[model samples]
Target: MRTQVAIIGSGPSGLLLGQLLATVGIETILLDRVSPEYILGRIRAGVLEDGAVRLLDQAGAGARLHAEGLIHDGFSLAFSGQDHRIDLHGLTGGKRVTVYGQTEVTRDLMAGRAQSGALSIYEAEAVTLHDFDRDAPYVTYQKDGQTHRIDCDFIAGCDGFHGVSRKSVPETALRTFEKIYPFGWLGLLAEVAPVSPELIYAHHPRGFALCSMRSMTRSRYYIQCSVDETVDAWSDERFWDELRRRLPAHHAEALRTAPSFEKSIAPLRSFVTEPMRFGRLFLVGDAAHIVPPTGAKGLNLAASDVHYLFEGLREQYRDGSGAGLEAYSAKALARIWKAERFSWWMTSVLHRFPTMGDFDQRMQEAELAYLAQSQAASTALAENYVGLPF
Candidate 1:
């Protein structure tokens, strides 16, 4: 099969790219390793930054999101037994975040593509990429135990950190950077009510605990643990006991451990690959960069990549130019590095360090205290959290 573009991974990045391209009458083929529904069924990040929501709306992908997604004007930082609220809307003008899951976003993108009768294939594993320097680069993969090849004008590698597209790039052209945290988050979604009105980032003597949500009926929560810890090590009784300690007593229902629908430990890390574009193969989303969930920038950054890439492609097709493609890597990297810095900053400041001395712990407390007391510090945090400017 042949297309103007071949997108690997049907996640939000790939699906959104295909949808954007199709709107411009650009033919695209989207491939993924799992069934579309299966990919959409997984639980992931649920915060949508202002720029991300607008991009979705502009691409005609925000019907369901606008209808069902919750809009939050602010978030609270809880520490020292007091709450400091950052007015996201007030600080960033009208920019507000929406409470929408990544899975839902992917579903909307896929449904939108299907309505247009676009080519999207699931259960397709990319074996390798070839001829990236040529006009017609292609990807080889297997489907239903049968080998297949797809030729395309360009390849967008959105399959994520473990996918084959990254490896296809010559090692000499790659410069990798990463920082793995000593702790991971044990996140869970329960059938209980939310403890706070909006998301809460709390720093306690025990560790860092976050209060978030999936919907009105389902509450999402996270607790910091050792990177090697397993969910099995945390029993229901233990989970509730720790929750009671970390969460304020004002939290409803004595914090019973509701039946957990989803449980996973995501190790905290910051990762990036220089020059996101390599010839005709362009990497986006997790395939190119990763951010700790602290700032909720992962999905938003991926959406930004697709937005820029689509813009660049239009320029290339318009004036018969190569400048846009040449500049794609640097442009995308600028935003990627900014988000990476914010995520790293938030993670380092909010999370408790195990090796902290008295002075170090005092410094962390002082920083939190300053943010809680000063409007300037609060606004800085609010701007970064609400979403960096496009």
Candidate 2:
């Protein structure tokens, strides 16, 4: 088989890239180690920046999103037993975020891909990249007791951190950076209305808590916990009680509980691999970078990465230019670092550190107070939260 691009994953990044390429007549074949059902089953964050939403629209996947997604003008920061709302719309000059699930975005992209008659092989086994560093690049995989080979002009490593794409790169060729937080988020998803109309980020002596939702009827809640914590230790009642304790009085009073259908503890970490391109292969989304969820930047960052790579591919295929591809890594990393800083800063401000001394605690309080009271500080937070321009 031959294609212009061989995408190594069927996640949103790969699907979005393929959809965008198809808009201009470029052909691609997607390979994934998991089934499509498994892909959609994974729960993830869905806060969409204007730029991300625009990219989805550009890919022709915005119909369901715009029709069903919730729009939030502002969100509250809970501390000192009170709610402080950051006016995202006013601060960012009418920009707002849409509450759409990542799974839905992937589904829309998958539908668009299928409708375009592109190729996607789910449950492909033993996928491997070969000669990506040379002029000729190809991929091999086993399926149904048979071997198949795909020769492509380029390879896209959207398979995520654990996938073979990044691991295929020689260690000496890549520079890595990482920081693992001391805590994790114990999240619960239930079929009930959210405690509040808008998302809330709560800072309390106990830990950090986030109140988010997939829709008006499905609420997602999380509270900070030790890194070693497990889902087995938390029952529905205990999780609800712990969540309530982290919120302010009014929000706690307004909170409603139901039997949770999903529960898990995810560790927080910030990781990045420098120079997202390796010759003919490029890493996208979690394959290149990861951010703690405090700033709600994971999916948005992935969208931005997809945009950069799509532009480069488009330039190469349509404009007969190599400049965009050459500049892709530097451009993507520049925005990536800014987002990393924002996510790191938000995590620092909103989370309780296990090693926080008395002085550190007071400083965190001062920072939150300043962020809530000062217009300048609030503007900065709102701007970053709504996302920076592409």
Candidate 3:
């Protein structure tokens, strides 16, 4: 097989890139190690920054999102047994966020690619990249007991953190930075109406709790848990009872309890690999960096990486210039570091640490109190939440 680009994953990042590239007459072949059904079944964060929403639109996958996605102009912060609203629209000059599941976004992008007649190979085994530093780069994979090779001008390493893409790069050429939090988030998906019209982030003596939803009737909630905790230990009744204790009185009273259809625990971490590029192989999304979900920047950061990469490839093919391709790493990292800082800051102020001393707990209280009272502090939060510009 021969193509202009070979994408090493069929996730949202790869599919979105293929959709955008196809619109400009660039041919791409996508390869993934998992089935499509498995990809769509994975649950993930739903919050969409303005920049990500626009990129989906550009990829021709925004129709359903605009139709059914919930729009939120503000969210509440709970501390001191009260709720304080951060007016994102008012503070960010009318910018807002959309609540649309990441699975739905992937489905839409897949449909768009199907309509355009793009090629994607699933269940590809042992995928490998060759000669990425030379003028010709090719990808090889095994399928159906046969070997297949794709010769392409460029390779996109959108295969995520544990995938083969990043591991393919030599350690000497990569510099990594990471921080793993001591706690994890115990999340639940329930078939009940949300407790509030918008998301509420709570800071309580017990821990941090969040009330969020996928739609008007499908709610998703989370509470900070020990890193060593298991989902099997949390029963439905116990989960609801613990959640209620962390919320304010009014919200606790309004909360509706139901059996959760899905339950899981995710550890928080901030990781980044410098440069994001190795010769003609460009790392996009989780392959290059990861952020804690506190600020809801995971998917949005991936979309921004796609935007930077697509522009570089487009410029290279259109004007026969390598300037955009050459600048891809520095540009993507500049925006990525800012998001890393925001997610880290939000996590610090909202969650209780097991090792925190009296002084540390008091500092967290002082920071939240200042944020609640100062308009400038609130605006900064709103601006970062709605997302920094692309």
Q: For all the candidates, what are their Cα RMSDs to the real structure?
A: 1.5, 0.7, 0.6
TM-score of each model, paired residue for residue: 0.96, 0.99, 0.99
| Residue-wise C-alpha lDDT for candidate 1, range 1-390, written one tens digit per residue | 888899988889998888888878789988888887688777898799877888788778999999989899998877777778888898878778999988889888888998989888888764678999787798888988889999988999999999878988989999999998999998888897777769988877788888888777788888888888999998766766776677555652435458887888899999999989988999999999999999999999998898889888877777778788888899899989999999998888778778877787788789999998888998888888887776
Off by over 4 Å in 1: 252-257
Which regions of candidate 3 are displaced past 4 Å? none
- Candidate 1's TM-score reads 0.96
lDDT of 2 by residue, 83-146 (tens): 9999999998999999999999999999999999999998999999999999999999999999
**CA lDDT of 357 in candidate 2?**
89
Ranking by lDDT: 3, 2, 1
lDDT of 1 at 169: 90
TM-score of 3: 0.99
Angstrom error at residue 346, model 2: 0.6
In model 3, the worst 10-residue window by lDDT is 353-362
Superposed Cα deviation of residue 293, candidate 2 (Å): 0.4
Any idea what lDDT model 2 has? Answer: 0.94
